[model samples]
Target: MSIRAARERGRRETFARLERKYRAGEYEEVEAEARALAAASRRHSRRRRPLPQWQARVLATGVAVAHGRGTEVLPELEALIDELEPVDPEAHVLRLIVRNNRVTVLNGQERYEDAETEALGILRDVTRLAHLTPLWRMELSALGALAVALCGQDRHEEAEAIARGNLPRAAEPALAGLHAVLVRSLNGQGRHEEALAEARRDPPHQDRRDSGLLDLVTAEALHGLGRRGEAEAAVRRALADCERHLHPAHPRIREARTLLGRVTGEGPGD
Candidate 1:
């Protein structure tokens, strides 16, 4: 079978097992395994060539690096980029994604300048893709901010602009996770009120666990708003949910707890 076909089959089998777990396995363990499978599936999709194939590769590599998939993702990215490097920079989608993926992956791994350049290149290409949707536009902006952040530029302002621009539309769509990232960008800029407003406007929910980042942003905004008690509660809930749904050592989980402790001076169990 083709690589794509194989991945698809693996995913189908994994999810079939997942369904059985959902039906009979222990709740917490099954949920945890399901989340892992979902992450792996996303990584698989990102690496496989399909629509916007390059971007998918980059995104997949980024997640892989962020989750410490390490050499498994980066080498593949480099090889793919090499194949597409001769293509027009604007249309060489695979190359562009590989470049950007390099940036996100390296940046996550603390290889700053390299990552920044790759990310910027991807952003430039994304901007030039005249045929973009509102969804893609927001994603491009957010990715632009990520590149800028890696480059150590004034990224928060840009991130906030992109996030805010897309925030209103988010409520109607299922972009709570994107909105949550914007909330962090807002909070980073001390736009606490706007961040709080955004959080209130889109409260976290049970099924929205992918948006665990939302909890961190909301908690921080609340703490800044002098709603420490509420912030603490939100942190506890977010942390608990994240622990339940994600790998224990996820950096986002560490970040959430760190911010929570800084704000409330209390642990999750406190």
Candidate 2:
């Protein structure tokens, strides 16, 4: 199978196992299983042909990120970019993917300024290729990352505008993530009603982690709107879902727990 196909298949299989574990109430095993899957994916190498060497490395970088080794992957990704042949169009495309992933890693790390700068640079470069079909997905990825970084910087209005403007009409996973970012930006701006509306929109998929995040955003929006009872319930559900699927120490779990506390008129907890 091609690298992308292999990666997708691995992810689906891993998520299926995770769901089984979750349904069996084996929450403690979920994180370890996820990490193991990521490690195994990184170790499963295919011959480099239909996919370029850099493309394979990008896939490996994604595995590293899944294993929470993004910091370690970034320098290596940079080195790969530096080694790329200048005139190679395929290399250029892979470079854009690498750069976009770098911004994503930075955003996850909460390095807002750095992410913002990198995302902007990506946007500039992508604009030149905006009309090209192959680069369109990368453009969308960069836009989503830029919106997220803007939210991290507390620039809620701009983030919301960008996210809303760029949101795809199709029910693609990437668009779902962008919609979540839009919901977060709305919540940050105290537009609770709007945030809830956005959250209520159809999601791209039923992925547990994404669903949990959507619930968390919904809970915060409800809380901001003074619907304490509903907020608490939403947050509780978010906490349960997230804890079942994510690492115990995952930031999303902590955020959900903190929101639950606030909704209950208590300070942040757990």
Candidate 3:
């Protein structure tokens, strides 16, 4: 098999094993395996004939994200991008993917401005592409990131506009995340009634993290509308759902806790 194919096979096998471990409730083992795979990939990349440079970096990035080391991988991804040949279309596509990953990392780190900047750059590059048919998925991904980053920055109106404009094209399962971004932007702007309405239109799948976020937005909107009883219940549900699915220190969990505190009149610190 070609180097790329071989690398792909390895990735698929590793992820399959990790998924099985996760399904079996072996989260600690899953995390350990993912971290080990990330380290192995990084070490392997130092070899003279390691998997293609971009492929190795992409593998490392995926592993970092899987292991909850998103922020830690940003510098490596950035350096990889700096070494790419910008004139090559393949390189350009890889750059977009890396930048999208960077946006994700920055967002997770709560660096909204940096995420917004990187996302905007990705969007601009997407526009410059002569043919977007092959890049449609990445384009939508960038747009989703841009919307989320805008919401993070409290530029809700702009975020809402972007999400609304792209919602139609986001019919695919992979693109459904745009809906969450839209709902979040609406909630951030204090459009409580509208946010609640949108959150219900096409609620996120129960198995997805977005579902927990949707609950959080619902809680926030209900609270803003002075429905304290409903808000408290919703916030508690959000907290429970997030705590069950996300890391203890994840930003989403922290936000849910803060919201619950507000709804319960206990303050976030308490």
lDDT of every model, 2 decimals: 0.58, 0.71, 0.72
TM-score for all models, in order of appearance: 0.59, 0.72, 0.76
Count of clashes in candidate 3: 0
Q: Give lDDT tens digits, candidate 1, residues 70-141.
A: 445678778767655434533365455456546644644556566556656666666675364223533453
Task: Give the C-alpha lDDT of model 3.
Answer: 0.72
Candidate 2 per-residue lDDT over residues 1-270, each given as its tens digit: 899899778666756766576545454365455455545544664643223334445655644444345676779768766765535566667677778878877886789899999888878877775555356667777888888899999999999888877775424546767888899999998889989998997755644435487788888899889998988889999888877665554557667767877888688632
Which runs of model 2 end up more than 4 angstroms from their true locations?
1-52, 66-72, 130-133, 168-171, 206-211, 247-250, 265-270
RMSD of 2: 6.7
Instruction: Output the better candidate (2/3) by TM-score.
Output: 3
Q: Ranking by lDDT, best first?
A: 3, 2, 1
Position 162, candidate 1: lDDT: 60
lDDT score at residue 123, model 1, on the 0-100 scale: 64
Candidate 1 residue spans exceeding 4 A from truth? 1-72, 83-91, 100-116, 127-155, 166-174, 203-209, 264-270
Cα deviation of 159, candidate 2, in Å: 1.1
* Residues 54-139, model 3: lDDT tens digits: 55456446445533457666788788677666676767776777778788778878899988888888878888884743777777
